[model samples]
Target: MTDAVRATPAARLRGIGHEFMEFFRDLTQRSPARFAILIYLSLILVFTGLFSLPFAAEDGRVTPFADAFFTAVSTICVTGLATVDMATHWSPFGHVLVFIGVQIGALGVLTLASILGLVISRRLGLRAKLIAAGDTNPLRTHGGPVNEGQTVQLGQIGGLLATVALSTLVIEAIIAVLLYPGLLIAGVEWHVALWEAPYYAAMSFTNTGFTPNPEGLVPFEHNYYFLTILMAGVFLGSIGFPVIYALRQHLFSVRKWSLHVKLTLITTIALFFAGGVVFLILEYDNLLTLGTQDAWDTTFQAFFLSAMTRSGGFAILDVGELNGSSLLVGCMLMFVGGGSASTAGGIKVTTLAVIALAVWSEAKGRQSNQVFGRRIPSDVLRVALSVVAWGATIVALSTIVITQLTKADLGRVLFDVISGFATVGLSTGLTAELPDPGIYVMAITIIMGRVGTVTLAAAVAASSRSQLYSLPVERPIVG
Candidate 1:
């Protein structure tokens, strides 16, 4: 301190810079969940500023800060609900800007930061691993307490990130190839076709509902090839990158899959097929939906809609035309969402599975939370319940706020609200017409959904004190 006081101005400035860097590292190292959340907020702000630029909009149109902010939120959150026409409202520069946001969002907020870290430092510090831990599920899976502070190794982190980035690019590239010729044959200009293919690929693979075309997916409604490619992308993307890596490493054997993988694969597939069957039964006679198509086409469209309901957001049939029962089903599916640590959002399939398992255990009077020949820890169960509880709270609060603002029907408001909270991007015709307050509310919902309930809870719980003494057990009356 004495030396610093005696030092020149340059030395003082250096000392200040060093102190700042250390503080930044400490902040990051302490709670990666909060750090990741910070990155998301910062990125959203940057994209909003970029969208606010006059050059980002159509030649004659000026996008208001609110609209620009909404679009930026949707893109960065990878929620496709749009306040305006993507193709007509945004200039190519704007589209590119949105695309960049989508790409980064789809890769994940922590993941993008880790990538940047690798570029700058050629290595990830312990802080980066803490953030990546949010995606990897180390604490529960490795049989540790909720407060376990284990960190993944640098090599494992590198491989995990490499698989995520490489797989995303490779899959998107392949889908783009499949979509290219169709775009050309559809009379799209060569330049536009070139962009649309990649755009659709990114959107689909990220499970984002955004479409590059003005008509949305309607023009390609009957195009099985187009829909198939998109469906495949969404399905694969919704399967977490961790699962994908496991599949890549051990596709030929069932033994290698972790319990988490097993549950996710089983639940995701069951949901997909069950959703298809339910829709087919419900919409079999509705002329506005599948009833208008020929028998074979109707079945395909029903299944396609089912796939999209898994947070993919690309709809061949108008969601608004579906029967009330189908709408209820859509809301349920959107709320359940895709896999853990996936670009797809919601409470996640694993959380749902855990809840169901817990229910079953209670019903059977089992002493342990058991599934897949293993005992799921108490911590996992607690986390799952917390996520579900928080998720429900968010959806309920958003529904009330949005309905109050828009004066929309309860059901329509519920659909849009849940869609925003789950980041499903599906709408019941209310998104484009939502008032400013409604839009702002939906934007906040998307952020919560994208950040995830568990992550948020963890960030808030960081300052909590550990119990040095256990409290006496007490039982409350059951429902």
Candidate 2:
């Protein structure tokens, strides 16, 4: 007490600073994934506060922190779920803020931090590297050591970050250029088209369904060229960064691509066909969907719906009118989502593929799960199963909460809940009507899904327990 009383204010400030540093040091060394989660949470809070300011809304009124927080979460998650109208409710400043937020969220906060670190020191310290490594590569969690060869490969972190940024810029630019004429043709003035092109491109390339046009993508539904261009943007954006980077280095040389890249492409393509076929069959005779359209139009619309189900979230038709069978397909596609390290959110296609291959191998009583002529790592299989379990638990729990809160039908509630948890933003006209509790529940789900269910669970379950001895093995009876 005597020493504390004698301490000056300056000394006390220094003591607090040192303590803060120590806290962060321990966190980074002990649980890098938790550190990354903290980084993302900090960004979300900053953005939420900014969105709550007076000028964020068009009316110059201080936007309610709840709505603002929802928007901030949605934007930072790149989820495209909105309670307020994006075009009419937001001022240009707000729009710009959201644009910046989406871009930041697309690359992830830790990724941007890593790039900034590279700029500052030209080399990340071990702690910073651990944070960046865990965020970018799921296989390299802080609970375990990374492979030696992979650690050397991380020496090119700077280059990989640059490639990710450059690839996003180039893809968005191309898509924007291609979409400009469509906006003009859709009756937008030249000046409006100029801004709208980039907006659409950003939303599309990020697999977000936020359209600048009030009527949404419906106006261009019949314009095959416009829809096709959007489809292209969505597909490229959801393909994941590692696959894109591999393509940049290897081009058309499939032999040079990584096994993960190969698996992503194959799974993505197969799901595209499977999803489209399901939609085609379910919506064939339904007038609200493809019933009135000719075969050509039906085929294109079905394909577009299939793409949207893969987390693109852009819908040409009202999803609420679809049959129960079509909704089932939608849920499956949304849950299985796009590739890992992608802007698109879900359990990830790789996770689904690994689980499926593991099941197939077990069915045939094989020694190990094999894919692309390589055996899947045992740890990867464990992670895959863990992801599915976490994803299912969240979806089930969120669905129950949402249904209880909103009293919405189970079908629509399931659809919205999955959409929220997958960050897919496709809704059956129910999002805006949700009560405050419902909105908050969805906000949590979007954050959970965007941060990743498995990643979030891992951070929660983080431990330093390294067993020195193995437990006795036991086998349980199977079906």
Candidate 3:
């Protein structure tokens, strides 16, 4: 009887091992979402390890595990809330790890993984292609079968990814080289200046807002060239990859631009300019900018920097130095966030556009939504509403939780919460002082922002392919 029991257990163990292997094989073949999660987790682990090393700390001493883990999480999520001052705590090696994490996180786990798969396999499978399409929200593939045009368009997505990466690198390289001389002129040593230039370049373009210097640009506050490069990088990075790709295609084929592209471009330009003007007007006499010697230059700088602060997290002037009204405006901008499918987060420009269109339609008594001379699809509108609703819910919950946890003022708490949800990293100097519970709340917000509101909603929604039945159509009272 004992021998029979032992044999049965051994057989079960073998069977389980075989099933596990099959599961792994199937995952490699068909699971893009799972693959994305794994890639992100792996990168986070690597960052955590590197940051735990003694050289990664700014004091040239080994950092605590919690601090390192939190920093790695913040970097990987591209949420720039730092527990410790990056410049003063981390060495060169540590800074590089943070930079690499920011780049990878901003590109996204699925995108980078898909690129790798395409490179290694030389072609994407149908499952992979479908996942890619869903993630990017490409237009519906038409006709009874796939065509060359669809394939070309899909290929262009890859090309666009490469273009964005290359553009970012080249721009940063130029800025680094340009800034090196400026830093040297500012009395920085050649070695320190050279190291910091590239560091700033990487941080600025990625919108990670991590400064290699502890003072956080106070010394370069008046340097036009430095500010210009930083602002340019931030703006380019905030614009979505799809918009950039569309712009490139439009340059080649002027008449074939999509409405999505048109809407994104218009909204982005309007928001940027409008936000700049708002900041200029509100902060004109504030100590942050008005205290400067050059009035016009200060105004211009304030406007440009305010635009950057919305999604980039790089505060050229001290955020703490801003007055109450300026901080309120900054919080609003941060909450609205940047474009869809971009490194920057929030409810997304598309969501905002859809909401605006919905409001316009209601005001006009229109039965259908229209924008850019085309009717918006019902499914698109549903997704947009869901994203906005869920995003607001999460942010509100986070604000409440963080307020309770930290006992901070409601405005400051709300600002930090929105900043985390948008991944904007602009703080009212409250991030580091938050208790452990507050940190966790921010961490969750960071994850949600980076993973995306829609993605998270989908994950929580039904995953089954089959639907039971459709409910009877009924109009609910919504105002």
Candidate 4:
């Protein structure tokens, strides 16, 4: 009987090995973004599985499985929406899991994995280069013979990743150090102040916005220096890394800025100021700000902080206290999100810029789209349109579903749905009140946002094809 049982186990092991090998083979040929999502999902599963153990929550108390899974997904996606409060509910072990997940999500799973592989093998191949190019949205390659070697240099990859990580750490560290004095003056213990400072720094820069303290920044809300540091970190994180790199390069040579770099910087600045002004105008009498006696100071702080709230989740005032119009505006900014190739999520400012430029050209009766005196390629416009269309569809569907499930106001439900899809993590206090199914929907949206709507749509729509014939073009209609 023992021998027969052992044989059965051996057969099962052989079957598992074969299945694993086949899966690995298929994944290697898949899109790198898909593979990256798989890696992130697997990590989340593992972390959640471990947290399922009794020792994972606070006070060694067993947490509900749903909460653990939800928390895992939230952290891995870098969406700060929590079904439960982090400060009171999660143990230190769970907090560590959240921290690790946020770091990986912010840096990107594939980028981190590629870095590890490069360190181990000390080489990157042509396939890897193509994947990296796709991930970064570089200009399409001219049709030419491909070389297995000399396509992408590992040094460039390492340099960019290292630069982003180092820049984030240095900026966050400075903010943490600067914040310590304010925290200490607020009567917080030195040790608690030190710990919370870095925690806030990491949360703010990663745009996770998960605060260690229950009151959030409300305690230091009136402190100008504290708000300044937090806002700076938030703004930097929302700007795309490629833009930052380009700006850094141009700083050394003022006349050599790339068109894309120039457009991104201008759009980002314009959006920030515009959003700030609109927020000031709308919320001038709302309880979160103007209801207080220091209306001018409150208005200025609200406007500036509202701009940061688009991508980063730090809120100076209570989000629930905003009026309907203010919430609507906030939702719009969150849906538009920050720049591409950065910690921020959404359709990206570049995509919005491209679409806007395309619209302007069409209205002018131009056959070709142009931006900043440079022709915008059709392929780039197609990508931009696809991202916006797909993102809108997702947000719309999720909003409908959540509205049905939660019976919340249509505007607030749509706002939360877009917030999730953009990975903006700002809620009008609806996240905690969401039902289980609603939480799952938001979780899926977060994953889609981080992976990118266009990438996800492309993965689903991908097919093998050979172009054999060209169709004749015909004009359809006039506006």
Candidate 5:
């Protein structure tokens, strides 16, 4: 009896730990969307604490909670928007935190979790595969008949994870190698260039536009080769990992590419040129922007701005100085964001592609949405529609609240809101000036944008039901 009494406290502690493990395991299997969100929030809290440390700042003072929290959200979300001076506010320790935060963030919440699980167990379990698959394809998050053809298959989840890790390392290494010479030519010290090269590489590839230097991109503003390298890195990062995996297997064979790959590439290329043309036309004569440059410089800068607007976050031109029409164009581009499952955010280019295809089919009086020789089911269209609706609602509410708080111009407010919502990191000189309240709101916007509308919706859903019976259908008049 005395021994039992002495052991009771330890026994209870063990029991509690076991129960917590069981609950976590269940959460991973039952609702990975929620699990992913939980992990992401936990990361934000941890990073926020780290950022708030006295040594995190250059002056050895404790950073304010608001800036630290906002920076944490921005880093984890891979959103470049900063409430504080990203270049000058943090100490070397803080900069290291940003570096590590973005690398983890770029791996994505679910993927990072799965990688951790893989390391612990030394195998990829079925549940772990499903969780990682959820990152690549939202349909895997809930119970339903999923079109596995639309995304990475269960068998490929391991390869996808490998690709995620290997590709990030390889691409960033190549980009850094390419950037080192440019930084040297631009007069940076060799030691500084060594660090800055990879820093810029990660920032570009992750689509988090935080610059390591106080001057941002001003020093390399007219360096076409440097700017072009950044643009290439952004393009690779924004085009979703599934697309990359597919392309890796079928790079030379265009016929073997999946429909997702087809749409992503086509729409991304289309938007790249189209946005550049629009910006070129709108900002051609604005003295504060591209207007001061010669014809060649102006043309290249317009395209560079277009690339950055699509979630690259690196800006050679001052985003605030563009024409109002140009700002609206930026809003549209930022709203579309990058491809799904990529480090970039927004509604995703694939979502835009699906909606555009559905519209095209409807206009043509077709019974189904067909693209690249495959039929897109109604459910996919419905989810695409839901993403658009939710995304728009989030942006609208954020813009309204921030507008009321800041009393800023609608154009600037809308641009920054959309930028936050899309995780584009482009700012109209407003994000840095936001008050604490506005900073929190914008942080929330970045979270929503990064977690994605579909995944966020799934995370909050009470439960997924099979619905064994069909209800009576009624058609309603619509626009």
Candidate 6:
């Protein structure tokens, strides 16, 4: 009788735990978007606690909650915006935390959530595949007749996950190896270079941009080889994993590339050159920026700045010293950001490509947006539009709130706000000066931006109720 009574509580506890896990598993299958957000939020909170510890800081004192929380968000979001000095503020422990946090963040939240779900469920079933597909294929979220050619097939989800993991490990390892010699040439100690190499590789590839040294990029400003490696890492990361996977499978054969791959590469390259030229024109004579350098240095720096503005966040120039026109240009580049499912954030390169193609089609009076011999669907375009609308709204609202809180200039506020919203770490010296309230608001913006516009919208909508019958279409007045 005594043994039976003692075992009852244990059995009851096990039952409760089982029920809780089942509920979580169901949530993952039903709403992967929310599951992702939940995971990201939980991660941020956990990191926040870690940073708040005394040992996390260089000084043997517990860090302020606000600063810790912001850093946590920035690190996990891979945004790199920091209220505290990233270089000198933390101990080796904290830096390691940042490194791990970014790797987790670099794994797309949806992908990570799906991975967790897979582990918990112990199998990649049809529903789990749909969850995984939500990451590689955003089209899966809006249930309809999906064109499988446009997305990673459900069967390929396992391969996609493998690609994501193998690519991240292999690419970052290669980047680290490339950076090791550069760090050595830059006069870093052999032992220090060991750590700095992988650290720089992670920061660049993740587009997190947190420098470990107190001097930041000032020492390596003249080291074009090192800078080029950084840029290369950023480019690979910003291009998105799906694009990488496609290229890996069909590198020599350009004909096999998907529309997403073609558009991402073409648009990314176009923006790279366009932004470089524009920056050269606007800041070529500005003494505070590129003017002080010689012609060669100036031109190189201009391109570097252009690359950095594409959500790389590794700044060779003082972003705050740039001309007003250049800042505006920077804002536009940052807002567009990198490709979808990339470590880099923003509306995404695909979004920009679609919108630009749509605009071009409209100008040509085409009935459908067509590109690279493939017809762009209306649904994809609609999602692109929604992404832009939500992104703009987030940026606008963040700018307004932060501006009011800081009483800073509109231009600076807008620049930093977009930087945070786009998860670009480049700051106009304003992000560091923000008050606590502004920090919290920026944190929210970073989370929203990193979570993604479509995912965020879906999370809010919760359950999608497909209409049984279509409503009669009514045209509103055209703009």
Which wins on lDDT, candidate 1 or candidate 6?
A: 6
User: Model 2 over residues 1-479: C-alpha lDDT tens digits?
Assistant: 69999999999999999897766666655555566578778888999898888787788888877788888888888888888888778888888888888887787545665665555444566766755655555555532554443321556666778888998899999999999998888778999999988888888778877887678887888878888888888888788876787778787887766657777889998999888888888898999899999999898899899998888888889999998889888998999888887888889988888888989998999989886666676788888888889888999999999998988889998888888888787988888788888889989989898888665765787674678999999999987
Tens-place lDDT digits, model 6, residues 121-224? 66665665775776664545443564666678888887898899889999999999999999999999999999999999999999999999999999999998
Per-residue lDDT, model 4, residue 52, is: 71
Steric collisions counted per model: 0, 0, 4, 0, 0, 0
**lDDT rank order:** 6, 5, 1, 2, 3, 4
What is the per-residue lDDT of model 3 for residues 227-283, given as tens digits with 9 covering 90 to 100?
777777777677766666666656566456665666666777788787778777777
Higher-TM-score candidate of 4 and 5: 5
Regions of candidate 3 where Cα sits further than 4 Å from its true position: 1-25, 28-31, 116-123, 137-152, 155-161, 181-185, 252-254, 288-294, 461-470
Q: Which pairs of residues clash in candidate 3, taking residues 3 or more apart in a chain or in different chains? A: 57-89, 57-90, 58-89, 58-90
Q: Encode model 1's per-residue lDDT on 21-111: one tens digit a residue.
A: 6665665666656767887898899998899888899874568877899999999988888888887899889989977888889887567
Strongest candidate by lDDT:
6
Model number with the top TM-score: 6
Judge candidate 6 at residue 11 and give its lDDT: 94
Worst 10 residues of 3 by lDDT: 142-151
Off by over 4 Å in 2: 1-30, 109-152
Give me the runs in candidate 6 sitting further than 4 Å from their true place: 1-7, 125-128, 138-150
Candidate 2 vs candidate 3: the TM-score winner is 2
Backbone-clash count (model 3): 4
User: What is the Cα-based TM-score of model 3?
Assistant: 0.86
All candidates: CA RMSD (Å): 3.0, 3.0, 4.3, 4.3, 2.1, 1.9
lDDT of model 1 at position 342: 81
Runs in model 5 deviating more than 4 A are: 2-12, 117-128, 137-151
